[model samples]
Target: MNKKNLRNFLFTNTFFIVLFLGILMVISLFISSNILFKNIYDSTIQNSVHSISELYNENMKYFEYFSSKYQDIVSEILDELYKNYINNIPFSSNLTIENFRKIGIFKNVDYYIINKNGIIIETSYDKDLGLNLANRVPNYWKKLNEELNKNNKYIEGISYEIKTNNPRIYGYLRMEDGNIFEIGILIDERAIPNFPKTVSSLNLNFIKSIYTYNISFIPYSFEFPLLDEEDKNIFNSLEISKGEIKTYTLRENSNGKESYVYIKWVPDKVNNKEFNFTVLTKISIDLSSIVILKNSIIFIFIVLIFFVIFSLALYLNYMTNRIEKPIMKLINNIESGKVDADAETNILEIDTLIKYYSHLVNTLVEKLKEEERDYLELKEKLQMIEKEKDLLYEMALKDDLTKLFNKKGSVQIIQKLVLNKESFSVIYLDIDNYNNILEKLGQNEANDAILSLVEIMKTIFRDRDFIFRVDENEFLILLRFVNLSIAQKILKRFVDALKKFNITSDKPYKISVSYGIIEYKGQNIEDLYNEARNKMEMMKMKKLELLKKLSDVNAEEN
Candidate 1:
C-alpha cells in the first residue's frame, strides 16, 4: 500500500481502538465499584443485624438479672419487717416507716405487700401505703396467687401498664407460714440502670418493645404487637412450630426509607406457667448517613478515576511527544523557515503533529488554572480554621472582669498538670462575712473589696500558678510543685496577706478569709473541690462553736 493510504488506515484503526477501550474501561470501572459497594453494604447489614440481635439478648439478660436482684431485695426487706415487727401492731406506725426509709431500702425500691385475702396490708411507697388492693390488683396477681397456692413456688413475670400505667416486671415470694403475703416490685422505665452502656454509644435510633404471652400465645399487654397480618395468617395456617427469628420489611409512607422489624421468641417458665415472650426490635438505617456515605464514596471514586485517566492521558501525551520528536523538530524547523530543506524527507508525521498540537495546548492550559484555583481555596480554608481556634481560645480562657485566666483556664492548666503527673496543691479560700459585708456596706463597697482581694491574691500567688474566682466570695489558687506542708505554709502566708486587703472606703471593714487546702494527687476536680469545701465548712462551724463558748464564759464572768 502507498504511504498515504497506510497512514490513514493506521490512524483510523488506532482512533477506533482507543475509543472502544475507553468505553469498556469506564463500564468495567462502574460495574466493579457497584459490586464492591453492594458487598460492603451486605456485610454491614449482616453485622448490624447480628449486633442488634445480641443487644436484644443482652437486654433480656439484664431484665432477668434485675428481676432476680429485685426479688432478693424485696424478700430481705419483708423478712426483716416480719422478724422485727410481725407480732407488733406498730408495724403500721410512722416510726416503723421512718426507720425503713432511713435504712435505704425504701429509698431505692418501690414495693407493696399484700395479705392472704389479696388486701394491700403495707407498702414502702407512701402513695400506696393505705390503698386497697382489691380493685386495683392486676390479673397477673391472681395468676401469681394461683401458682403460689398450687406449686408453692415464687412467681415472676414481666407486665406492662397495669395500675400505674407504666411498664413493669414483677416477682412475688410467698411467705413460709401460709401467710400468703406477696411482694411486688415496680420497675423504673425512665432509668434502665441495668441496660448496657455500650448499647447507648452505638447511637441506635430505635425503640424496643418486649411482651410476654401465655402458652396459648395470647398477649397480656400492648407492649409489643403480635406478628403482622400476613405473618399471623401464615402462622395460623401452619401447625404451631417452635420459636424462630422473623424479619419483616417496614416501608415508610413519606420518603420510602427502608426499615426492618425483627421479632424473636423467648420461651420462659415462671411459677410453673409456661410463657412465650416476644421481643421486637425495630431498626432503620440513618438515611442521611447512608446517602452521604454512598454519594461521598461514589464522588471520590469518580474523582480518583478521572484523576487517574487524566494523568494517564498526560503521560501518554508525553510519550507521544517522545515518539514524535522528529516530527516536532521538523515542524519547528518549518515554522522557522527551514522546512523546504527537509521537504524531500518524510512529511506525514509533521502533518499529523501540526493538526493536534493547537487543541492539546489549549486544554492543558485550562486544566492547570483549575488545579491552581483549587489549591488556593484549600489554603484559605486552613487559614480560616487557625483563626477560629485562636478566637475560641481567647473567648474561653480570658476572664471578663480582671482580664486574666478564668475558671476554665485554671481547669485546662490543672488537667494538663494532673495528666502529666505533676505535683500541685489547691487552696480554696472564701471571704468571711462577705455576704454580711454586702448587706451592711452596700454593693459599691463590696465590689471594691472584691477587687482589692483579687489584686492581693494575684500578688501573693506565683505567676505560674492560677487564681480564679469560683463564686461570689470564693476563690481557688492552683499552686504547682507544692506538697501538703508547703500548702499549709502558703495558707498561713495567705491569711497574713488578708490583713492587708483593704478597700479605700469611708466605712472600711477588716477583710477576714478562711481557706481549705488540698494537695493534688491525681484526683478528679469535682472530688478535690468537694473535699476542700467539706473542710472549710467544718472549720467555719468550729469557729462559730468557739465564739458561742466564749460568749457563755463572759456571761458567767459577768
Candidate 2:
C-alpha cells in the first residue's frame, strides 16, 4: 500500500471508533440512571399510599360511633312525640285539622295521613302531598305497615327528606280507616351543642410525632380554595371529564411540599347503608434525604466511568471496581433514605408495550360507550311512543265530565271479568228525582249534585272497585271478589257518606240515592243488568206510592 493512503485510512477508522464509543457509554449510563430512579420512586409512593389508607380507616371509626349515638337520641324523642299526638288526637271523619296545620306551619313538623293503598290522602308538608310511598320505597313502607299491624309504634333513624335532601327524624303510627299517620321533623331542631357537624377541612397537629397533617372532607360537589376562580372552573371541568373516581391514593406535589393525596369514602353503616361521605387526606413525607443520597451515588458512578474511559488499557480492572463498589453499597438503603435496584434491559420494552395496549383498550372503550349511548337513545324513543299510546287509551276509557269510567270502559271490564269467570256483583243506582231537581235548581246545580254523589260513592268504595257513569244521573258499580251481601254493605256505607254530605252542605235541597244489587252466578250480563235496573224502578214506584198515601193522610187531618 502507498504511505499516504494507509495514513488516511487509519486516521478515519480511529476517529469513528472513539466518537461512537463515547456516545454509547453516555447513553448506557443515562438509561441506567433513569431505570434506577423509577424503581426507587415507585417503591416510595407504594409505601406512602399504604400508610395513608391505614390512617384514614382509623379516622372513620370515631365518626361512625357519634352518628349512631345521634340517631338513637333522635329516634327516642320522635317516638314519644308521635305516641302522645296519635293517642290524644285520634282519627275521625269530622276531625278538625286546623290546630295540627297551625303547629305544622310554626314548627318544622310534617304529618301524613296515608290510605290503605299507601297514598298520602292528606299531608301537612307539600313534599309529602299525594306521594305513593308503596311505589317509591317499598321495603321501608312494608316495614311500617307491618309495625302498624303489630304495636303501631315504629321509629326509624336519620334519613334525607324525599324532595329537600335535608336530614330528618321520622316516626309512624296506626290510625282508623286503615290509614297510617307519619310524622317527620328537621334534625337541626333536635341537635344540641357538641353535635357532630360536617366539616370541610381540618389541620391536626400530632404533638408526639411532631407532624402537622391536613385532612379535607370532599363533598360530592366541591371547589378547591387554593385555585383562582377561572383555574378552579377549568380544573373542575377536567375532573368531570375524567369521570367519577374514588378510594385511591397517589403522589402529588404542591407548593414545594410532596405528599400522598388520598381519596376515601366513609359510609354511614349505623344509620343508613346507602348514605356515605368522602374524605381527602394529604400526608407529607420528607423525601429530601433520599433524593440527596441518590444524587450523590449517581454523581460518584458518573465520575468513575469517565476515569475508566481515560485509563482503559492499563487500569481497566481497577476503574471497574471503583464504579461497582459505590453502587453495591448504595444497593443497600442509606439509613433508610435511598432505594436502589439492578437495572433491567426489559423495563423500557415492557413500558412501550403497555402504552400501545392502553391506547387500543381506550379505543375499544370509546366504541363501547358510543354503542351504549345509541341503545339508551333508542330506548327513550320507544318509551315516549309507549307513553303516547297509553295516554290515547286512557282518554278513550275515561268519562269527559266526572272523570269516571264510561259505558265503553265498563263493557270492557265486564267482558274481561266474564271471560276470566271471576265472581263479582253489579250495583245500579238511578236518581229518582233527577228531572224534578233539574226543573228546580237548573242544569248547573244538578251537575253539581251528580258530582257530589260520585264523590260520596268514591269515598265509600274501595279503590279496587270500579265505578262507571252509564247515563245522566244513572251510575253503575262493579265490585270484584265480592258477593251481593258485600255490595249491599257498600251501598249502606254510600248512604251514610251521602247523609253526611247533605247534613254539612249548604245546598237548597237534600240529596238522595236508590241502588239495586245483583250477584252474577253464571247468568247473562244483559239480563242481570236489566234485573238490577228493574229492581231500582220498582223501588222508585214504591216510594212514590208511599208519598201519595202521606199526602192523602195530611189532607184528611187538615
Candidate 3:
C-alpha cells in the first residue's frame, strides 16, 4: 500500500487522466472494428442463404401450380364421367383408357388407376399397366398414402420411379370407387429454377470489394477447385457441425498471409431429399491503400485527445491548487498550535468553509484562554485560602502575648511524644512570686517580664526542644532523645539565664522562677506533668523557709 498526500495525489492523477483516456480510446476502437467485421461476415452469409431459399421457393411454387392444376382437371373429368356416363351407363359399358387419353389427361403425363391392393389395373402408358406400385416404388407410394391418409385428399411430391428412372411430380386422388387415380409429370431441367448466376457474380464482387478476399462455392460431396494439400488441410480443420444454420468465421494462416475465413451451409433439395453445400470465403486485407490514411486519422485523433486532456489537466491543477493552498495554510495553522493567519479563497463553498473554520479556531482559542485564566484565578484563591488557614491554625496553637505554644499546644506535643515512646524529659517552670510582681508593678510590666523570660529561655534551648507556655505564670519544655543528666543541664542553664536577666519595669527588679524536672519515657502525660508540678511546689516551700531564717538573724542584729 503506497501512501500519498493530497497535493502529490492530485498532481499525479492529473497526468493519469490522459493515460485513462488513451486506454478507453484503444478499447473503443477494438470493439468498433470487431462489430464492423462481424456485420460484413453476417451480411455475406445472409445473402447466400437468402438467394438459395428464394430459388427453392420458386421451384416449389411451380411444382404446386403444375400438380394442383392437373389434379383439379382429373378430378372434374372423373366426377363428370361418374355422374353422366359411369353412374348411368349399364354394367356392360366399358370405360376405356382412350377416354382418359382423349381428355388430354395423359397427353404429356402418365396416368394410372390403382386398386386397393396397389395393383395398377389401368394405365395410359400400356407398358406400366401390370406393374404394382408396391413392388416398383413402395416407399414413395407409402409416403403419398400417409399424406393422403391425413386429409384423404390429393397429395403430391417429387419422386423417382425405380423401374422407369423417371423423376416426376406425382399426385394421387382416392376416389369413391375404392381406386386411386394417380398422375405423374416428368420433371425436366426447367423443373427447379436457378437463381441468376449474375446475381451470384455481383454478390461475389461486392464481397471482394468489402472484404478484400476471394470466395468459392462448393457443392457437398463435390471436388473443390484446384486446392493444394495445405489449403485442403486448412479447410478440413474447420469442422462444420451438421444442421448448424449460423455462419462461422475463423482466422486462418495460409502461406504466412493472415486471412479471415467465413463458412456457411446452404441447403438444396434433390428428389425430395435435403442436401447441404458450403460457401467458403478467405479474405486477406490489403493494407497498402488505406494504411497511410488510417494512420493519419488515428494520429490526428490522438493528438486532439491529448491536447484536450492536457488542457483539462492544466485546469484541474489550477483548481486543485486553488483549493489546496488555502487548506494547506489552514492545516499549518492548526499544526503550529496557534491561529495567527487565515486562508482566503474565491470559491464560494471553500470561502464559506474557511470562514466557518476560522471562526471556530478563534472561538476555541478564546475559550482555551478563558479556561486557563479561570484555572490560574482558582489556584491563586486556593493559595490565599491556604495561607489564611495556616495563620488561623498558628493563632489557635500559640499564646497571643508571648507568641509561645499554649496549654493545648503543650498537650499536643506531650501526646505525640507519648505515642512515639520518645526518650525525653519535661521541665515545668513558674515565675516565682509572679502575682506579687504583678501587684507591685503594672500588668503591662508583668507581661513584659514574661516576654523577656521567654526570649531568655529560647536562647538557652535548641530549636528541636519544645518550649511552650502552659498558663499565665507557668511554662513547660520538652527535650527529646535525652537522659536525666541532659534534662538537669538544660534546667540549670535556664535558671542561670533567668538570674542575670532584669525586668523592664520602673522598679527594675530581677525575676526568679522555680523549676521542676522529670525524665519522660512513654509515661502518661497528665501524671508526669502533675509529678513535676509537685516537685516545683516543694522547692518553693524550701526557699521560703530559708528566707525566714535570714530575716530572724537580721532582726537580732538590729
Instruction: Please write out the lDDT profile of model 3 over residues 74-147, one tens digit for every residue.
Output: 55544443444335453111243345554332324556778887888976667778787776546546766776
Best-matching candidate per TM-score: 3
Q: By the TM-score metric, which is better: model 1 or model 3?
A: 3
lDDT of each: 0.59, 0.61, 0.62
Considering lDDT, where higher is better, how would the candidates rank from best to worst? 3, 2, 1
Worst 10 residues of 1 by lDDT: 207-216
Best by lDDT: 3
Candidate 2 lDDT, 356-380, residue by residue in tens: 9999999999999999999999999
TM-score of 3: 0.36
Residue lDDT tens for model 1, 134-185: 4554544576667777765453644342334333544455667554444443
TM-score of each: 0.35, 0.35, 0.36
